[model samples]
Target: MGKPTGFMEYKREKTKEQPPLERILNWNEYASRLSDESLQTQGARCMDCATPFCHMGIEVRGAAAGCPIQNVIPEWNDLVYKGKWQEALQRLHMTNNFPEFTGRVCPAPCEGSCTLGINEPSVAIKSIERSIIDKGFENNWIVPRIPSHRTGKKIAIVGSGPAGLAAADQLNQKGHSVTVYERADRPGGLLMYGIPNMKLEKEVVERRVNLLQQEGIDFVLNTEVGVDITGEQLKNEYDAVILCVGAQKQRALHIEGSESEGVHLAMDYLTGVTQSLLDSKFKDGKALNVKGKDVIVIGGGDTGADCVATAIRQEARSVYQFGKHPELPKVRTDETPWPQDPNVYKLDYAYEEVAAVKGRDPREYCIQTKKIVKDKNGRVKELHTIQMEKVLGEDGFYYFKELPGTEKIWPAQYVFVAIGFEGVENKIADHFGVNLVRNRIQASIKDFATNVPGVFVAGDARRGQSLVVWAIKEGRAVAASVEEFLTTSVKA
Candidate 1:
């Protein structure tokens, strides 16, 4: 819906990042916003495809194809192209409660399914979206919109991650009184600790949280729901309780010596570093110190990449990341056709940082860790690994075949496992009496009601580990269900 011919005239330009070597010196957001003019030009690259798949917001083959929150990509792109910055921001906020968060961290599946991306590079949707909201904040256009009237329906939301925050915001906007509970000292769950500051500054998260508080949502921090207040107590106190507790039960390495000292979960390492940075800038010596030590991160994906970046920032003597998947092709493959998120090889920010300093990418694909070797004092001393080849099996499935002769040992003092999470932690689910299916809270999407009446579940707790965008989508959906339940069933 942008300039009909603009897509042919202009090439896509991505948000610029500070040089890797320079940015690794500090834990601050390294990406720089493109100029307004450049963004408008990028926006013009949105083609007027008869069917704009960029906003389809569907899943194909278990992978997201477009904006899960159903952001009207073409409309906002047109507005931005026409220099209607405020209007673009309005369109962005209509679906996404936090464009800033998504803009900064979202992998942007929307761009993957862009019609123009079939042959050419996709429109800079993520950057344009980020610019619009950022401009709104800069020009004082975004403010807390206090609900005109209170419905007196109180909602207790457990977990302050993206899902919880989005649900809280939506429920508050719908005139329901909302209180969010976080076990951590801070309000933002994943945004606060799970992510490093270099990717998203804490102040950015705090800013949105402060606005939410001003909009009449209550945040009870450092209080675990099951430990501090039981689920039954919350159900009695509030009209409804929604669980947004993320899937944080990390999958562990089953290999020998996995329990050795100096081995840590990626989330633990990230949370500790962020907490220490916020608490005392690591002056208290509480943060994990990888300085001058050889570090190896096991597993791959965004979490593994984040571990690599954090290790680099900590001045590790050397860093290496291991992944079981083979390196992706440089271009989109038939296996992942258009309208599906492209599986292609591009250097992530973390890989770029490592390459800048080491003169080579630190990721070793198609490798599997066999064991963690411990030293005399029982700390991690080395890692044993073997190369693997992906083979198509007779059952029409692919399996990894280990190459026996390729076994090797690498020196390491720290081993961060970033294999990802299994599902929701059991304590909260058990305490709430919510039924779990495959470790995820069992709730139908039609109505996110758990087995317990008046209690609902959303986000990763219900859907398992997923993107922040998906979590926000669930949060919004569950809020609607809660609103209907409160109106139709609850007594004033």
Candidate 2:
């Protein structure tokens, strides 16, 4: 809207990234910020479309079509183009509590649904968003907003991930006392451990957590609610309890020899590496060492890509990632039309780094692991596999059909399963006496209220594993629900 013909005048230019060969040597974030002038030009590329689907925040065909948090994309783009950095940051925070986190790792479904993307490349919305938030921090524009008055009500939030943090921030700003419980040593649950530093630096997470603390939110770290503090105690101490303890039960590969030594879940491997890196920079020898070992990662997703990047940084001898599904098409398919999150192929950061060093992409599509062949000592030595073909059945659903006589074996000392999470851990939910539906906490999206009184659920715990932006949305929604509940209960 800032420049009507700007989309036609300027081509989309993304932020610069460190060369894969150079960045793989260290764990720092590889992407560099675009200059202010360049970001302004990119912002100007936002088309003044009447029907802007960029912030619709709806799911199309089970995939996110736009920003889940409903970020005001056009307004911020206009603000940035007009050199109103502070205003842009304010508009950004109006929807997203953690733009830095989502900006770095969210996959950017908003871009897939961008109006300009139907014809040309989408405006660099994500890059401009990161620039606005980063500038806000750099210029000291963001500060603690301590509540002037207390609502005389206490709320306890279980988990310190994005959802929990967002809920705590919202509730605290509304003058309610909030305490966030975290089982980990640090405040950020997934952002601190599950993600590698090269993608989302821990310092960024810590900076926000510190700000929340200054805003009168209490953080209780290294304490599990169900174990250290019982549900009854929480119910008695706090006016209400909100559960944001993400879906963390990793799905296990049930093939033979999967229980062998040197075979691990992807999240476990990532958490160990990140913890060790922070504790002693890996000098503690706590991290799983893949140095000089041929590594194989099963499951073709972002977690698998993260494992590939981590192994490369640890100097693995060889690395390969397997995906049962075939590679995505270069262009959008019939199943994913315009405004849907495009199921397209592009080199991810990990694949790029591996390609630079290995002279080939490390991904093997349509490959499924048959079993893990182990040595006499019970350590994984070879990964057995077979190719697969996607075939449509008479039922009109596509399924993977294994190709006969295409079996192969590959040498591997370490095998990591990155097949994704199943649901919440269940232990905490059981203690809280919340109902469960298909592994998720039984809570309605309308109110985020559980069957039990004074207890509510949100985020992955209620909706299953999803994007950080979605989690934040649920967090904000649950906060409003809790506030209304508190107000009504007082009147009752």
Candidate 3:
């Protein structure tokens, strides 16, 4: 729709990034925006297929296959190509409330499902999206839309993460009084703490939260729902309640020295560093400092990469990342075919820094931590690891097989476990009397309504840990459900 021959004319290109070594010197965003001409060229590459799978918003193998928010990719791509940036921004907002967050953090599943990607590189959809919203902010196109009339209904959103914020935004737009509760000192939940600043700056999150405040939504910080206030009080006070509390129970590492002073959870390490950076700009030395120390990061995911980057920034003497699974193929394999999210190898920003400064990548594949040896003072001093191989089991599945004579030990002064999370904490769910299926809150897929009347669930609390895009999608959908429930209940 952008241009019939646009795909044939323009090749795919993305924004450039600062050199890894130069970027590692500070805690700021490394990727720079592309020029207008280049962005327009990238937008022109959209084929606008008869059936654009890029915005279908389906799930494949527990991962998003396309834009979960079902963004109007082709329409905005056309507007950007024609230099109608404001119009492009308008189209973007129709589906997504905060494109800035998704633009920075989303893995760009839309590109993976692009029709052009069937053969050549896909159109630069994510970059175009980032440019459009950033341009909107520059031109002052984003502003609070205060509802003219009130519905005389109140909604309580427990958790200020993406899901809770999105739900609050939608409900407020419909003229309902909405309040968001955050247990942290600040709002934005994972966006504010769990993620490091280098990947997504804290100010970016604050900007959106500020706009929500101006739009008539109330935010109560440092107040948890189940603890500070009784569940009965919330149920009696509000017309309806929505739980967006994230699944943040970090999985425990049962290794020998897990409780050592120097061993910490990845979330705690990241949160402490970010909080200290915000509070005193790191001058207070309140955060975990790993300077001149050997660091070991367990589990190889985005969180592990972030931990590695953070330690490097803190001037760690050395950093090592251990991944249980073997490295994936550089190219897409038959296991993950075309038009799906491929499990191909990629050098994320943090790993790039490790390679640049250390003169080699620090990842060790097919490895498992056996124990964390502690010094006399109860601090981690060494990490024992074992090499692993894949072996077929009786169930006809391949599993990690520990090799007999491949034990090794490395000097480690600090250890960060970045394995993952278990599920939503049971306290809040039990307090609210909501059922749990496999530790996740049980809510009907049809309308997000829980087993208890007028109680709803969304995002990680309901669906387990997932992408930010999915959280936003769930937020919007759950808002509609709340609206329907309110209307029908009133009529009855």
Candidate 4:
């Protein structure tokens, strides 16, 4: 509520991005920050309505509608609108442990639910949030607040993603000795590897991890639970264990020639490229080379887009992406009215990059792959696909019906399946005797406690594939539950 009429005075101004052509040439973040003055103006647009839905961390249409962590949106916006940046940063950090990560990667559901969005463009809350945290870092306002006292209780976290990290941060604040175990050579889980470098640079991930280490959180990398160490060992050694292992098991394609040499999983391919970039800067060699080859990416979600962008950067001859769903409307429809997550079409960075370099958008809607054509040497050579139309079935649901005579083939030397994940891998949960329903650990959200006492779950491990914001929320909530469990046990 900085200005009563601020919404009328300022139009929403989005952060600028480097041109696709120039940005595609490098693996750096392309989005540019707005000037401090411009951001303040954007902050002014926060109507700060009496019933603000921006901070209502609740479910809408079976999905998160606002900030999952319930960030103090209006208060911070008012702080920024008046140039009280230090106060804004402090308020922002009160709930969110990692604003920097969400500010870059989150889809900003807060904007969709903004009061002004009913008629006008919503406030640029995400960009303003990014600016607040980035300024805090630039001014060295972010430092480890070491706990003044230590609790003898010890805890073990099974993953090092956002959920695990947030839990560690929160539990450490309670003076508990916390150690996070990551199976990968590095922590941050998908944040470090699943996401491409251009969207969220690895350096940013490293900086946060280093800060966590400096704050006295112990990290045990290259150590996986249920493999390197038994689940019984963890239960015997630590007072409590929290599992935050993310949903990483990628959905697989089951068409013919699926085992061809040139076909690969999207994460496996993306991970290899990133590891190579970090190790040798892609000079010596690459883990999976797509140079001069026609690349076809299946699944048209963000991961599919990342595959397209990565192939373009690898200098692929051409790229194509297939989506099983029909093309989304350019504007929000009645099916997804205002205040709901908009199901609209807008060019993402990778789509923009492909269109710029190839002179055409490489996406096809209502398409399904029929077969993966392979060369004589068993490498993927092309893809056969067919167009589909939605037909109402007797079950009262629309099903994709293949349109005959619409089959086509395209040259594709490399194929990457970018379909979404199924659920959490079962090994760790099984080892710990935790029940899993639908590949997610069976833990009550009310307490975040599993069937096994002293065992808990959070993030994708408990909720399936979800946004980073929700993961952080789950982490913080689980930390509180762990604290309560520890206190009750000590009293007994």
Candidate 5:
């Protein structure tokens, strides 16, 4: 425990963002760091509960209830509170491979389950975590641990996302050589591109990747398996293969006029913007510009928020985000009680920018895109939408019925569809002769073995779209299973 009565004495505080007007001019991270003294005070709030449900890592009704990676929350929190950050970093790495990413992006389920949260504001577990890793870097304490012994096995990890990276890290530490393959020019998977720059700086990703490289992990980039390299070649070369490819198949609008020029899928548009930034070119050459366009962002999850933020920075004349659900409550709602991810509302950075520039928040709740109206030249000119929403049934059962009699049109020169993703593309899975259950590649929780020998599945490719924490957890678990299979060699 950090401090005996720390929880009672302290109030929750968080990092602040730069002024919206100033932040919108470019793509740079906005959140300011909590000072060292403040962070220590926040860390002392950990109650050190007897049960510590925060790290139990259990599934409650098919949703994560605690930290998926079962992070040693109390131990690290206490260490940070005591200002022993080097030891804290050691404690953190025992479970998680990348606190930096999770620190930036994870929704922080651990805080929700915190004992302090039973009635009051929880300990700033996430902020404490971020500080620990930052200290690790500042002190140059993070270093590669080359395994002392060798299992004489090789593992090939497909996709360099968090899952794949986690798997490789664990397997390598267990004395097996691992290689990660990425299709993109640079690695990091979704972290490299799907997420915008203003939230997570690219330099943060590269610094960690450089560490991985120094650790002797081989990265083969600009290579697409099932295209550049055959699946059979991979099976013959490595003792085991793991797929951490995420769910990237973006869901589309079946509504009319979707095929028009300016109507683009969210991922496709995001990818283009990111790629252009990385490549330093746009359609006009030199500077990639979405400037002066009236952008309409569809869907209301984090991706939608990201799209809104990205467009604002690109100098869009106006931006509107259409969410099918009604506005979330300002406080936790009855439907989502304690320990569930709170559906409470706080304006994300993007929404804040939209408000600063446009005189109001850009979100239009309970609105569904009816159709995309196009100009004579086949470019999107406007969007037709319906203001309808789904509500729970009063009869104590599951219900999702749409409300009626709400439709309107808004001028939109560019449309970015930010609906969520489906499972990974099945072509490679089918090509490898692995069986898929439902949409994802099937593997029991006991072990990540796929239908084919020497093949395993983990992360979003196996579990469908999910959090990065879950991906890392699955990766570590799967790595152990693959290690056992190769080491035992039919011992059973």
Candidate 6:
């Protein structure tokens, strides 16, 4: 929509990062920003399709596709192309509340479903998005949007993650008095704790939160709803309550010797290290210093990769990651095709960092940790492992089969379990008396309303543990339901 021939004039490109070797030395963001000139060119390649599937956000193959919050992709791309950065920022804020987090971390499926991607590489939507907001901040365009008057309606949000933030942002825009409660010392939920600052600088999170505070929204930190305040009290105090408490329970290892010291959850390890780095406080000497220690991370998901990279930064003597499944292919498979999440091998920042520091990938596929062994001091000494085959278990659940005589032991000073999460925690669910279908809060993706009339759930709590983008989507969707409920109540 910028220049008629803009698509033809530009080629798909993005900002390159500081080499992994150089980036691992500091706990800062790795990717370098695209220059203003290059950003304009990339944005111009948006193509402006009549039917922009990039923002359509479909449910193809029973799984969601495209942008979840329904980001106005093409419109903003065109604005950036025309050098209207401030205007682009306005258009972006029409839906998403935190482009800073998503632009950096989101796996841009919006680009995948782009019509342009059917033939050529999709527009650099994520990069363009980051540029617009960055430019807005530089020009002093991002300021608090205080509502002219209050509606006298009070609302309580149960979490401070992206979903909670999005719902609070929208509800505040409706002139409702909004308060967000977080159990953590700092808000931003997992963004402030679970994710490493090296990947996403903490100041970025603070910058947005500061702006929110200036906008008159109240944030009550270190107070959990179920603990500090009862669910019934919240319902009584506020006109409505939105539950954004994310999945906090981690899927754990079932192997023998699980109680051994030096074995910890992946989230626990990352949280301790990041908190220590922030407060300059270490555990006795240092926060899980892996220097000169051999490490084995026991999962293949994003958390596992994060452990691998974090271990390298701690200067571990050696690190190895075990994956239960077989190695993925380099290209998309039949089960996951174009426009769908590709079931392929891709190096995340942590894996890339580990490979850069250690001179190898450090990942072993089709292997499972059978048991852990501890030394006389009760610290983990080694891991017994073997390759496994895919088969049905006696319990009727499919599991990996260990081949006989394939057992091997490797010295391991530390073992971090990076497996995925279960559903929302049972304590809070039981306390609220909310029912769950499959560990997830019982609610449709379209409407996150629980059986309780005034209660709503969102984010990883509603969709199981998922990407940040999906959290935003669920938050916005739940906002619609909340708004409708509020309007109906007012009329009655």
What TM-score goes with each of the models?
0.99, 0.99, 0.98, 0.98, 0.95, 0.93
lDDT of model number 1: 0.93
Total clashing pairs for each candidate? 0, 0, 0, 0, 0, 0
The all-Cα superposition gives candidate 5 an RMSD in Å to the true structure of: 2.1
Q: What is the lDDT of residue 353 in candidate 1?
A: 97
lDDT computed for candidate 6: 0.83
Model 3 vs. true fold: TM: 0.98
| Alpha carbon deviation, residue 319, candidate 2 (Å) | 0.7
Q: Write the per-residue lDDT of candidate 5 for residues 313-336, one digit (tens) a residue.
A: 888999998887778897777766
Relative to the true structure, candidate 4 reaches a TM of: 0.98
The runs of at least 3 residues in candidate 1 whose Cα sits more than 4 Å from the true structure, single-residue gaps closed, are none
Q: Sum up the clashes in candidate 1.
A: 0
Comparing 5 with 6 on lDDT, the higher-scoring candidate is 5
- The lDDT for every candidate, in the order shown, is 0.93, 0.93, 0.91, 0.91, 0.84, 0.83
Q: Candidate 3 residues 21-99, lDDT tens each?
A: 8988999988868999898888888996898889989988777787999998999999999999999999999999999
**After superposition, which runs of candidate 4 have C-alpha atoms over 4 Å from their true positions?**
490-492
Candidates 2 and 6, the one with greater lDDT: 2
User: Candidate 2, after superposition: displacement of residue 381 in Å?
Assistant: 0.3
Cα RMSDs, all models: 0.8, 1.0, 1.4, 1.3, 2.1, 2.7
Residue-pair clash count for candidate 6:
0
